[model samples]
Target: MLKKLGQFTLSILVVSLYSNITSFANNKPLTEAEFKATKLPYSVMAYSNKYAHEYGLDASKAIKLPKGLEAIKLTLSKSFSKGYGPYASKWDYNCTAELYVDKSLNLYWPGDHAKVDKVDDRGLQKSQISTAQLEKKGKYWVPGPYASMLYDAYDKTVKADLASVKLSFFGCGYIPSRYTAAKDGLAIWLEKKGGYNYAVIGQGEREISSKDFYVFKLPQNLVNSYLPYARMAAN
Candidate 1:
C-alpha cells in the first residue's frame, strides 16, 4: 500500500512539472502592457476599433471588406428586391465583419449562391441559360452554385499605392451586375485609404491568363458585398 501510494505521488509530481514546463514553453504569454503596445497600421487600428465597438465580433465578424485593408470587415447587404424590385418571397439581408491578422494577408471571398427558382413553368428572370450558352459569353464566368462570381472581359491593372492616384473600384456605369454598380468580378476591387498602397499580382478571373485585379464600382447601396481579406505576400 505504501509503495503504490508513493508511486502515485511521484507520477503526479512528474506530470505537474511537465505540464508547467510545456505551458511556459508552448505559449509565450503576452502581458497586457505588451498587448496594448502592439503596433498596427493607422487605418487598420481605427477601422478595427469602430467595428468592435459597434458590432459584437473581435472587429472582424463581417466579410466583404476593402482590399489592402487590415482590420475587421464590417458590411451590410440589402437586396433591391425587398419591397421594390423582385424576389420578395424569401428574402434575406446580412450585416457582417471579417477580421484578418495583418496588412500582409490577402483574403479570398468565398462565393456559392442558390438556385434560381422559376416563378412559372415557362421560367424565371431572364430565363436561366444553360452553361453552354453562358460560357460562350466569356472565359471568366463559371457555373457557380449561386449567382456567378463576376469577371472582366480583357484584363486590367493599376497602382493602388500611388500618392496621387487613389485606388479606385466601383462606380455607377460599371456595375458588377446590371443590378450592381460594377460589371466585373467582386474579388478584384480595391481602394487606397490614407497614403498606403496595395499591389496586385493576379486576379480572380482565370488561372493567370494575365496579372490584373478589377477595380469594382461600388455604390452606396451594394457596399455590403465588398469583403476583402488582407493578403500578405509569402516569404
Candidate 2:
C-alpha cells in the first residue's frame, strides 16, 4: 500500500509541478493492474520529523501535513470519538479531538430539527481551543487535499452504510474557544453501523489503549508547534 501511495504521489507531483491532470475519480475505480501499467496522479500531505516530535504523536509520520501550514481544522467520523463503538479505530479516533467540554444547549435556528445543540450563553463564556472539531453550516473551511481524498475514498470504497457527512475545516487554525474533547469523533453518533474501518494501509501501527479520552496527554505547546504541519497537509 505504501509503495502504491508513493507512486500515486509522484504522479500527482508531476501534474502539480508541470501540467494539469484532471479527474481522480474515473468511470472505473483505480485497479492495481491499470496502475502498474502507468503511474497516476495522487498527492499526500507530508509531515516533517521536527513537527512530529513537536506534536508528541508518534503514530504515523506517513500521514503528512501540507507544507508551511501551522494547523488545519477537521471534522472526523464518530468512530474515533471517545466512548467509541464496535467499528471505530481506538487509535485515530482519540480524545485529542473529542467535544469534551461541558456545554449546555442554549438555542438553535431551524428549531434544532437535526438535534443540533446550541451552547447556553452562560456556558463557557469564552475559553481557549486547543484541539480541532467539525463545523456546522455557515462555517468556512480550507482543508488540505487528503481530507477530501479520504472522504471520497470512504464514499467509494467502504461498503458500510455510512451516513451523509458534510464537514469542513479551515487551513489556518481558528479562534473559536469551545472544548472539543467530547463532541467530535465517532462516539457522538454519526454512522448507523456504529463502527469505523480504515480505508487501507496503516498495518501494524501502534495505538494507545482506550482509556479516558486525552490519555495521550498532549500538551498545548506540542500541539501548537505540530499543528502547522497538520494544517498545511490538510489544508
Candidate 3:
C-alpha cells in the first residue's frame, strides 16, 4: 500500500512538472522585476506602458489593442526581437521589439534609435506594408482556426492548379482561403472544361463557375460557415 502511495505521488509530481513546462512554452508571465531586468525594445515597452499598463510581463492576459487595431481579434505577445535575417533576425537587431499576434502573425514596430541606438543597427525602419495599412484592412483579419484550416487545405492538397489562378484542391475541397471587408469570402480555382478555361468559386454543393471571376461572390451566411473551422483551428 505504501509503495502504491509513493507511485501516486511520483505521478502527481511528473504531471505538475509537465504543466509548468507547458505554461512556460505558452509565454507565461514573468515577475515584474524579472521583466524590467531584460533588454526590451523601446517602442514595445513604451507602448505597453502607455496603453496596456495592466499587462506588463503577463501575456497570458489579453492586452487591449489601440483604436486602429480594434476591428480584428488578435492576441499580442510582448517580446524583444530575436534578431534580423531572412528566416529570423540577427543578434544585432535584438534591440527591436516584436508583437507576436498569436501563432499566425508577428507585428513589429520600430524601436527608438536614440534610446537603444548603441545596439539597434537594423530595426526594420521601412516596412513595405505598414501598420496603418493593416489597420485599414483589419476587418479582413482571418481568425486563427480559419487561417489554420486554409493552411491545412493548401498543405494537404492532392491536386493543384496554375500558380496564377490562386487555387488548390483535394477532390473538391471547400477550404476558405480569403475573406474581405465587403462581407465576402473567396476561394478560386481554374480548370479547362469543354475546351474553355473556367474560373470556379466554392466547391461541391455550393459551387459556381464562370469566365469572369469577379461575378462569383459568397454571401455573408456562407462565409460565416467557416467560422467554426476557424475557431477550431485556433484552439
Q: What digit string (tens of lDDT, one per residue) describes model 1 on residues 1-235?
A: 3222111101000111111112121223344554234332101111323333433333332323344332322222333333646645443333222222222323121122111122122111111111111122244433221122121110111112111111111222222233322223233222212211122234333321111222221222222222111101000
Scanning candidate 2 in windows of ten residues, the lowest lDDT window is 9-18
**Index of the highest-lDDT prediction:** 2
Relative to the true structure, how large is the alpha-carbon lDDT of every model? Answer: 0.22, 0.23, 0.21
Q: Which lDDT tens digits does candidate 3 get at residues 1-235?
A: 3222111101000111211111222223345554344332211111122222222222232233332121111111133456546657422211111111121222221232212213232221111111111211232321211211100111111112101111112111223332223133332211122322211233222222222111112222222332222222222
Global CA lDDT of candidate 2, please?
0.23
How far is 203's C-alpha from truth in model 3 (Å)?
Answer: 23
**Cα-based lDDT at residue 80, candidate 2:** 35
Error of 2 at 208 (Å): 38
lDDT by residue (28-127, candidate 2, tens digit) is 2334443334322222222334434543433343233222221222222213335455665442311122111111212111222332223222111011
**TM-scores for candidates 1 onward, in order:** 0.20, 0.18, 0.17
Evaluation by lDDT, superior candidate among 1 and 3: 1
> TM-score for model 1?
0.20
- What are the C-alpha RMSDs, in order, of all predicted structures? 23.0, 20.1, 21.1
